[model samples]
Target: MKKTAYFIIGLSLLFSLLHAQDFTYFEKEKNIWLQVYSNQLKAQALDSDIKALERSIKEAGTKKKIELNQLLQLQTSKKKILDELPQSFDTMLEKITVESVKDINLIEYLFTSQKGKFNIQTQRLKILKQEFDDAVAFLTKELATTESQENRDFFKEYQLKKALDFFENASGLLENKEEVLKRTKQSYMSELEAYKQTQLPIHIIKIAILFLIFLLFNLLKYFITKKIDNEDRLFRIKRVLNITFFLLILLMLIIFNISNIVYAATLIGVIAAAITISMKEYLQSMATWFHLSFGNSLKVGDRILIQTNNNQIIGEVINISLFQVTLYESINNTTALDLKRSGRTVFIPNNFFVTNYVYNYTHDRMKTIYDLLEFKIPFTCDTKRVEDLVTEVTLEATEKYMEIALKQFSSLRKRYDMRSREFRPRIHFIPDTKSSCFILYIWYAAPYHQIMELKSQLSQKIVKKLQENEIEFCSN
Candidate 1:
């Protein structure tokens, strides 16, 4: 009976020892897994930092470039170390399971192997932490010294402030990552399980759905536009499709976080108010554009004259956009000397139409205009003959446009109540007392753009006729 009791006691002790060893093995396995996850997180963060540093290097000056390059190298090396960490936690666990728990030698070997790996990981982390601390201290000292020094250079001060902000942010990021790493090291199995649960496949599906929707919208636009032949209609359709797609995207993004609807609405309202206040003039211009588009007061290819305080501008409307009207400066009978400025593009703000008068010469499709030509003649030289000669020459020059002008006037009379006016050419005599001569004025109907050339032709014809008829002009 005594021997049996002693044997039973010994067996119980052995079982207890085995159970304790098993528990220890499980804890070590969990610790290795935690470290592996921590390394992965650190590597992701380092990747983000590396990309940011590379971008900063592109824009940084010579001195800053050197410092950033060094920091970049340090971050790259740290990431490489993190990436090389053993990620085969499952394999290691499987290996432990394949071996018998009663095999003490096997357990010892596995434990030592895992412990060595853990120690290497801890050592690497310590080295990286020390480097981060050194970088933080150096940056903080540099920032404080830079802030204390002052100069009169605005650009230099701005650059210094930017650099200080970069350093401060980097320091804050490093400190935050270090705190996270420390917290993760102290975390338990519950926290690890929670992290695994949070990385659900649904999140990936949501992202894929968003990309698919974007592609579908683009395809729809492409197919719809491909069938349309009219450029104007296509442009309008494209604009509408783009706006619709943008609104749809916003709606989807909002739906994705419907729990934060109140916050989103508030943010949107604030942004809208700010934009309205800051872009008041631009908003007005855009509103005016809608009116110009639907209203008949303005259209592309119309001749318009805008009078300002200092001078008048006459141009042909080439394009009408959302915020401005584009015009091609054209030489007119009134502005004949502005040849140098002709054909140059002019941009007029759409808001300019609200307070100013725009004179459209071709209003109601009136294509012909009355142009005047003036020449001086002696007060005593066959006034009646000169008048008849001028009238005859003017009538011949304007013969082609006379019928068109008459028809346009007839059409206008039907559309609007107006007085009858002569469409034929006419000659008038004005006495210039200061110049001691009579100014012969000849008025003729001509196309809006052809006025300058037609006037030149008429002048030559009139001078030739006068010379042939021995008509003398008064010379100063």
Candidate 2:
């Protein structure tokens, strides 16, 4: 039993060591790539060098063999220096810097410099120096232009200088990044060493699967676009689908915890948080959409007064979405005939309504009543006689529209325990406080839209009918 336990423990320890080794190697490779990505200046210089070298090689016709021999000798010398690189990566880096400086001196021998070429080279060097100065200025501005002196000191003394030193060293090492890349590629190609037998199939399969996934995604997008004409909805669906698929792919990669899924997830989460924070306005609009979907407060077709810009707009609700609530714009409580003006739609942010007062005129028609018209006449006009005259006149004028009003009023009143008598138009004669006369109050059933017209017509007809009946007018 003791021997078996020892064997198992040894195997576990070996597996753990192998796992750590794999992680460290992978991390180092990734970090190297990241460093290369950060050194854009070096990359550009390398590209320029490669182009120049290529042109020189192409131009050298008769001297091609001699030029090639010189280049080979220089390369062999650089390789010998590289071979003597220190075991310590840091020390190796220092040696690499020294070797690069030596290589720069050797470049003069490889390329013949004319008198004018020296001037051009001097100008180019001057430009490069100016670029470094500009970089320093930008970095200093970012670091030093801080509210706190302590923070500025930290950046100026440590971070800024560290970054500057890194850039400077990288710039020196990358005398020609393109040439280095070419040499590396040439070496790799010459060796052409295949990956381990077990790893080759896995890598091939991964590439094939990635290709298939891309094809499938495009095909689905094509079909989905055809089905959904709404660009916003399509974009949302596509974004969600992409995220889901990406997660699935990541999960598959991390099934054995061999890949950097955790790192990827952390990066994605940070990026997502940044995006959400940046797009706060858009997110607020989305919150308003959620309010519209579940909230029983506002609905389409309801007449509401939205107070924004210190302006009140009472209109019928036309459209409701996440970002905006569109209302068919109203003028003087009426929808315009022309769709552009009165019928214009106002797209207001959903959250704005919550912050401000949203007057829903059509919340429940039962709780509200239409306009109540009350008219005053002299007491001498005979209270009972006047009521009869005015009531008859109102009934005659409103005969066509009264039925509809009564129907609406009846339907509205059913919800409340409102007094049954409040639904009808009643003429009342009350004592006038002013001008020594009693006021004959004529109450009538009316729609809000035609209140002005109805009142004017009723008044005129009552006066005419009274005069024809030889009724005496009361004096103030």
Candidate 3:
């Protein structure tokens, strides 16, 4: 209660003091203080103006120096006049002893001034801020110019360099006025930092978007080409897509403003060229794959004969890959009969296509192939009769195969310039005196894949027929 009474007493005193003042006396004092504040600012401006005159005089000819010094002296007089104006305000302030509205106004004036002068050096600060704003404008113009240039990468570097130069220049200008320019410095640095912050995310987004586009383009190209059965065509299209992706990246790297585009591109090119030169066989295989994929000569699932190291690798193509052709190997004995699968998978590099001849049975629509089986018969049998019987029986046995083969290889006949072909056994009489025997060649045609089954059946039938006829066969 005592503390409350004291506060009330203090409030009453303050109100009584305010009421005692004349009408608008505090407002009058405040206006007077405002004038004093304006005069103090003028004083500082006069000082700076005089200093500027001095600097101008220092750089002038003798005649011009005299002229500038006279102007500097005139400004010094004006500063002296302003200097006296603050003292009058101080004297007036001392006469107001009561803690009234005028006193509050005086306190406000004191807070805004020090040593009877304006403490705020807004003129110099405004000039410096204008300089910073001008520099920012110039920087913006530089960015616009950089954006207009054809060499975006180089010009963006130039833009950043010029921006840094402006920042350093502004920093140096502000360094001497650290106390006064603190806020301006913060504003300048924050602006630059903001630009960098925005640029970083944009750069990251550019790279990510470019990568996604590259991946998507490749996936789309792959899916579109995936259904194609032609290996060489697919390989060619993929090659073009890959090269396009790389070039697009090179082009967009400039737009992304990545600093290392030239260096990165050069590095990639050097590494790729080195790898290409080092892996000649791999490169050759890729080229060979391209050729075979479009050459219509060899494809996956086609039966082929790849002769290597003085031996023949007869196989059905299982896969056609970038570097190699995979095969499911098969074999036929030297007699061209008893064809059987060896069950060995073979990988033949496409490079070997350049160095060796490849035979593809499925090319030219010649899916059916002919093989001959020769049997040595004793000279005791009538050779003419045996040949006729063997030919007739073999023709009957291969009748179905011939019907299908002739229909399929109509293309082959046109390709090979052949008039007509008959599916029948051709017997030649070869006298082997050492065994006193003659050989009969039983020729027949069958699909390459069904050759083994057809040969086995024909061999069994021929043996059974000979046995039934009581024909004696010579074995060497």
lDDT of 2: 0.56
TM-score of 3: 0.43
Candidates 2 and 3 compared by TM-score, better number: 3
TM-scores of the candidates are 0.44, 0.34, 0.43
Per-residue alpha-carbon lDDT of candidate 3 for residues 129-231, written as tens digits (9 for 90 to 100):
4555554554556556667888775634553465446455645444445443445434444644564566546656876899798889978796968687788
lDDT of each: 0.69, 0.56, 0.65
The residue-by-residue lDDT of candidate 1 on 1-476, one tens digit each, is 54554455345435434433332322232344334433444555567667767876776668867977897898789778866775433332322211112222323433432334334544555654565455445435544665677655443345435534544554554455445444433443334344346633444566787899889989988898789999989889998888788667667766665676786787568756976898788888999999999998889988888977757888899999998999888877546664445667889999899889998867777888888888899888888899888888888888879988988888778878999887888788899978988998888898887877898888999999999999998787
Model 3 bad stretches (over 4 Å): 1-273, 334-341, 414-416
Ten residues in sequence with the least summed lDDT for candidate 3: 96-105
Error of 1 at 413 (Å): 3.0
Over all chains combined, what TM-score does candidate 2 have? Answer: 0.34
Per-residue lDDT of model 2, residues 295-317, tens digit only: 76788777777766665676778
Better of 1 and 2 by TM-score: 1
